[model samples]
Target: MTPEQNRHAAQLAFVASGAELNIGTPEECPLPVDQLVATRGDEPYVRERFSAGLTAHVYRIHAQGQDWTLKLAREKCKVQNVDGQTSFLNEIQRRADLRHLKHDPLLTDRLSAIVDTRYASFRHGVLLSPWIEGVAIQAWDERQLLQLFDTLVALLLGGLFEWDLCTGNTLDDGQVRLFDFGYMYRFDPLRAFNSNGTAMPQFHAAERFETRQYFAHLLRLEQDGERLALDAFTLEKRIAVEAYQGLRAELASRGAAPVVLDWLDGIIATWKRALVNDVSELYLQEAWRSHWLDLHDDLSGQTCTPSTLARIGWLERTARERYADVQRLVVVESKNRLFDQLREARQLAQRWQVA
Candidate 1:
C-alpha cells in the first residue's frame, strides 16, 4: 500500500476499534494519506511500522519539518469507561506546560511542538511531540556519568526537582532534560513539613518520598563512619545503601577513580546540607560553584584502578552488613509486637469461650 493509504488504514482501524481518534483528516472513509504527509512534512520520514510501547504503537515521524514522534492508542486499550478523551486532552495540556517549562536551563530543550488532532474516522487518539535525542544518563562513561549526576542534583535544587529523578528517567544532551512529567510537582522544602513530621510536597509524592528515603539511607551510611558490623536492625537500610554502592563500584571498576568518587562524596554532602536547610537552590549552586569545578578538575583524567575497585567492593560489603543489622532489628521488633497482639487475642478468645 502507498504510505498515504497505510496512514488512512491505520487511522480507520484505530477509530473502528473505539479509540478516541484525535488526529486524522475528516470527510474521508479511511482518511487521506496525503493529508497525513502534508500535516507532518516529509523530513524525518514516517516510520512504516508502529514502534511497540506499553499501551500503544508509536511512530517516529518528521512532522512540520521537524523530528517528531507520534503515539496512537491500540484498539484493545479502548475499553468502555476508559477516559481516553480526558487522558488525551490532559497529555496535550501537560506537554504544553512542559514546553513552557523547557525554557528553564534545568529542563531539556524541546525538540518538536506537541500536536493533538483528530482526522476523519480515525478512532485512536494521537500524541505528537519532538523526539528527544541523547544518551540515557545511566549509559554515560565515568567522567560524563559523574557530571550527569551533578547536573541532576543541580536541577533538583534549582526548583525543577521532578521527585522522580533516577537512572531510568534522565537523559544527557550536554545537560539533562527530564521526561515523563506525568508526576511532576513543585516542591518547597521549608513549607513541606506537616505537623506529624512528614514531608508532603505538591509534586510526585511517591517519587519524592523515595528520593528522601534514599538520601536518608546515604546519611546513615555516612554516620556509620567505620566498617561497622551489621545487625538485623539495620539490614534493610544497609541493603539499600549497598545497592547504590555496588553501582558505584561497577562504575569505578570500569574506570572511575578516587577523585571521581570524592567528587560524588562532595555532591552527597552538599545534597545533605541542602536537605537540612530546606533550600534546593543552595545544592544547585554548590554543584556548579567554583570549588566544585576545581574538584571536578582534580578528578579529571583520573581512572579507577584495581585497588580503588577493591575499596568500592569493601564499601558495598560494609553497607550490606549494616543492612543486615537493621533488618534483624526490624524482625525482632515485629515479633515482639506480634507476641503481644497474640496474647491479647488469646485472652479475648478465652473469655468468649467461657461466656
Candidate 2:
C-alpha cells in the first residue's frame, strides 16, 4: 500500500480493534446494539433479505415505525482482494465523510441523492441506513442522467470518488439515489483526478459510470440496433460534457493544479469534437475501452459472472469482424493474439461465476 493507503488502513484497523467504533449515536438505532449486531435477517423486524452482495448481507427491517437497511459484513468477502476484505470498513469511513460533507451549506441540496447513514460499527461489522423505496433503473433518461451527473460533480469537488456505479448500486424513486459506499474512496479535490491521484487519468467519474453501468445498457441497446446504442451514447456524452465543464470550473475556482485543470480540458475537448463530428468512431472506441477495462476488473476480482463472459464474447466478435477498425484504435497485439488471450479469459470467467 502507498503511504496514504497505509494510513487509511491503519485508521480502519483501529476501528476494528475492538474499540467499539460507532459512527452515529447508539440512541439513534431503533434496536439494541447487541440485537442489531447479531441479526441474521430472520428476526421479526426483517422485512426483506438481500444476500446477493459480495461483501455483505443486507436486510430491510421495520423498527421504530420506519424501514432501514441493515448490512452485515460477510465472514469471508467473495471478492479475492484486499479491497474486498476492507470494503465494509471503507464504507463506514465514507459514511462518516459523507455525513460531514452533507453538513456543508452548499452541498446539502446537491447531495440529496446520497443516502444518509443511520449508524455503523466496524467491530460489529454492521451498517445501517434508511431503506430507500427506489427500484433499480432499467433505462437512463435525461432526468436521470442530469441528476446523477449533478451529484457526481458535487462528490468530485467534495473529494470523494465512487468507482462501482453498477446497476445494483443505484436506485430511482422519482429521483436517483446512491445507497452504497463500499467502493468509494477519498482523494484531494484540488490535486487529484481520482482516488489514485493524477497517476491514472484514464479512470474518472464519467468513465467509471460508463464502464461499470452505462455500457451494459448500451450492450442491450445494440441488440435492437446500432442506432439505438449510438443515440444513447450521444445523450450520455452530452450530459458528461456538461458535467465535466462544471467540474473543471469549480476545481479551477478552488485553485486546483494546472495539470488537473488541463486534464479536464482535454477530455471535454475530445467529447465536444466527437459530438460535433462523427460520434460513431468515438462510440466504438469507448465501447471497446469500457468492455475491456470492465472485463479486466471482473477477472482480477475473481468475481466473473455471465456478464463477464458476455464482454468476452463482444471482444472476440469485435476483434474477428472488425479487426481493421480495432487496429485503428491502436490495439498493439495481432488479432490472433487477442483471440488467444480472450479465449483463456473466457475460460477463467466461466469458472469463476458466483453461485
Candidate 3:
C-alpha cells in the first residue's frame, strides 16, 4: 500500500480498536505537541530518551499526573528498506488490533500482556502509552518462556500473528510485556497456521521465539559448554511442548479446522517425544533451522544487527564443524550452495549492519 494509505489505515484501525475502551484522546493528552517536539531531553515533565527505537523518537515523560511513553515518528525511519519505512504505520495498525482485543473479558488479561496504546495520531505522527519500567529480556527462564508463549497463543487464536519477537521488543518486570507491533499482522487463525499459511507450518509460536530470541541466546552460551546450551534448549522445549498442547486443546474446542489442529499436534508430538526420550537431536535440528531462517530474515530486511553477525558466525562454524550432523538432520536443500550463500551474506552483513 502507498504511504498515505498506510497512515490512514493505521489511524482508523487505532480509532476503531479503542472505540470500546475510550482510553484517551489526543485532546486529553497532557503533553503539549509544540513543547514535546521542542524539548530536547528530559523536561520538568520528561525523563529519558529511548533512542533504540528505529522508526520513532521515544521518550519517557510524566504527564496527566503519571509517567508515560511518548513516541514521535521520524521523518525517515533508520531501518534500511521498505518494511522499515512503513514500520510506524504498521505498528499502529497492529496496536489498534491488539488494543481492541481487551474488550473480551476472557482475553482482557491475557492480551493485556501486550502494551496498551493510550493515544495515537498517524497523521500527526505521535503515539502515547504508559511507561513500562522493565528489564530487557536477556535470559529465558521457564516463567518467561511460558508467559511469552501464553501471549503468542492468545494472539494466534485471535488471528493476530507477531512476526518480530526480538529481545528488544520484549521485557520483564514480574511479568513479560510485549511493547512493539511493527512486524505483527493479522491472519485467519482458524484457516491458517500463521500468516504464511500451512506452507510453513514450522513457523509457529514456539518456533518463532526459538528463532527470533532463544537460539540467539543459546549461540552466545555455546562457548561456555555444549551442556549449558543444550540445557537451555531443553528447558525451553519442555515449556513449549506444554504451551502447544494447551494451544492445541484451545483451538480444537474452538472448532478450528482439522488441518490446523493436526499441524499443532505434530509439533506438540515431536517436542513431547524429544522431551521424554532425549532432546539433543531436536536441539540441534531446531538450532540449525532457527539460525538459518533468522539469517535470511536479517538479510531480507537489510537490517543486520549484532545478532545477525552472531548468527552468521554460528552458520559458518556449524557448516565447517558439523556438516555431517546437518546432513543427517537434512536441514537444507544443498550444503554447497548454502555455504556459498552464507559467505555472500557475511560480506553483505559487514556493510549493512543497521546503525
* Top-lDDT structure, candidate number: 2
Local accuracy by lDDT, each model: 0.37, 0.89, 0.80
Greater lDDT among 1 and 2 belongs to 2
Once superposed on the true structure, which residue ranges of model 3 sit more than 4 Å away at CA?
1-24, 37-44
Worst 10 residues of 2 by lDDT: 3-12
TM-score per prediction, in order, is 0.37, 0.96, 0.90
Compared with the true structure, model 1 gives a TM-score of 0.37
lDDT by residue for model 3 (1-355), tens: 6433564466557545743322357577777666665655657877888777778988899877789888888888877665677677777777778777878786887887888888876656777888898999877888888888888888987788887888888989888999988777777787788776666777877778878888999988888998999999988887777777888888888888999988888888888888889888888899989988898887877778888988988888888888888889855747789788888999988878876
lDDT, residue 163, model 2: 90
Per-residue C-alpha lDDT of model 1 across residues 233-343, encoded as one tens digit per residue? 133223323333443454455555464455444544543454455443432232122222222221221321232222233333433444344343232234345345434
| Residue pairs that clash (backbone atoms under 3 angstroms), model 2 | none
- Clash counts per candidate, in order, are 38, 0, 0
Cα lDDT over the full model 1: 0.37
lDDT at position 213, candidate 1:
27
* Alpha-carbon shift of residue 111 in model 1 (angstroms): 12
Ranking by lDDT: 2, 3, 1
Candidate 1 error regions (>4 Å): 1-44, 48-52, 63-65, 73-90, 102-124, 140-163, 166-168, 186-190, 193-323, 328-355
